[model samples]
Target: MNSGAPSSGLDTEGLYRVSGNKADQENIQLLFDKDHTVDFRSLGISVHSVTGALKSFFTALPEPLIPYEQQKSLADAVGIENEKDMITALQDVVKKLPQIHYDVFKFIITHLHRVYQHNQNNKMTSENLSICFWPTLMKPNFTDMASITATLVSRTPIQPFILHCPTIFRSRLEPNSFLQPAEGKLIDIEAEPGNL
Candidate 1:
């Protein structure tokens, strides 16, 4: 929202609203076009490479895949880190997310992963990219799912590809249980747990 660029339209019902003049808006809109951006291969559906604001915008949809209204609950859900709880919460939110939103999440994450491998050249990590794209990535609640993604990446070492997977972000407690912080007890043995 801080881009200061006028919003060309609003993304509602899991849609992307590209901001700018009509032409720029139209050009960015091609992202939704199956012919221009979508790709499906052995692994799964993929987004042909594209970069900059368009990619950022795709990742920064106004209505988060988690939904604007659910921010508070997400804190608890993401905190618990129980795979089943996380998965259940995510499944609930994802069901409410429009199909278009799902596609965009998939598309942006795919592109970001490819970008990460070469991030050294670009000097952008998942955390940095998420910040730069903050304007587009934020939700109405003034928070971003990317922030969570960055936290996950920083707390432990994981493949860049894993960072881009919506499922991982949605159901965060994977790869050595990073999603759920350490819980309970602080006897001599428990002095300072990592997740605490």
Candidate 2:
């Protein structure tokens, strides 16, 4: 009487939360390959599709592993302005993250900065970034004792604000952050950091 494929309790209504297919595996490998370069725009990769692929890759891994604690520590360490200290702090944090998280986080740290730079040149906004990015890679709402609580609470798959809203969050920081000029100047601090 059933016309559809047989059910597998592993998935949801026949839809899998994660996939380990050949294509996905290749994407993941391409993402973190030490020798291979990953330029989304240069490679003609669709931003939306890239996010989907990243999510699939992350979900496909074994479970009971969220880097909430490690991510928090890393974030706090990265806050420090000292480069050497930051690297040491980052190393410590990396050691704390789960295996999958360490891989994903390292990949993100190395690659996401490029994506952010590209997005900046395109004048991409936070909402646009979210639409083009995925938050699962960074573990939404992740937290630990040493770091700030992750604020990625978006129901949408794309969560740039939580992931890294270079456009939007930067402005939020400007109004309150020390990046502003010590002497008051008649300029839009929120417009651009260097402009003021």
Candidate 3:
């Protein structure tokens, strides 16, 4: 009674872990693309669907420290005393999320700051920035949701941004086998009869 393709012997629970391994190899390709101070300490982790494609990925930085040139502007916007306090505030939020993988959490916070800066400079846009984190769990145990909520709410006045968690699912449906005929799609009925 098996009407579908044979199972590939892959465990669904282990799909994410395996996909993450492959993502690591792919990330190495980024190094060849451009030259920058590659922070090898920061690793990328991604989940894959049962179909063997990437679902989501995460990247992390050491910590959130505003550069000296931009510290004054960011401080003024957040109404903080100094850049050190700003860094501490960001750290506090990250500290609350002990259960979240370090890479993912850092990626989220880092992009939040980036968006905040972009808005301040009047460069906000709908296009997503190259962010490095993906939220996977529905209810993260390490960090309180209220903290994330508060941070997002506070930043709303600055610019639009998205926080996503990775998830992978299996689909049994297959794509269409053949392209549809396109002969009759165009409507040239209005053309002059002389053209014939």
Candidate 3 per-residue lDDT over residues 133-163, each given as its tens digit? 1222122122544334434434331111132
In angstroms, give how far residue 121 of model 2 lies from its true place: 4.1
Q: Local distance difference test, per candidate?
A: 0.37, 0.39, 0.29
Q: Order of all candidates by lDDT, from best down to worst?
A: 2, 1, 3
Candidate 2's displacement at residue 16, Å, is 22
> After best superposition, candidate 2 residue 152: deviation in angstroms?
10
Q: Highest lDDT, which number?
A: 2
* Model 1 per-residue lDDT at 99: 65
Candidate 1 segments exceeding 4 Å error: 1-50, 55-66, 73-96, 142-196
Q: Please give the range of 10 consecutive residues that has the lowest summed lDDT in model 2.
A: 1-10
Candidate 1, residues 2-99, lDDT tens digits: the string is 11111111111111222224443344446445344322121111111112335455455555553444434434444555666655664454455456
Quote the positional error of residue 115 for candidate 3 in Å. 8.8
- Indicate the worst ten consecutive residues by lDDT in candidate 1: 187-196
Candidate 2 C-alpha lDDT tens digits along 1-196:
1101111111121121223355644664566465344433333333334344555556555442345545455456546567556555555555676665544443443233323344444443334443433344444544434223433223332232223423322322335333233568322211111100
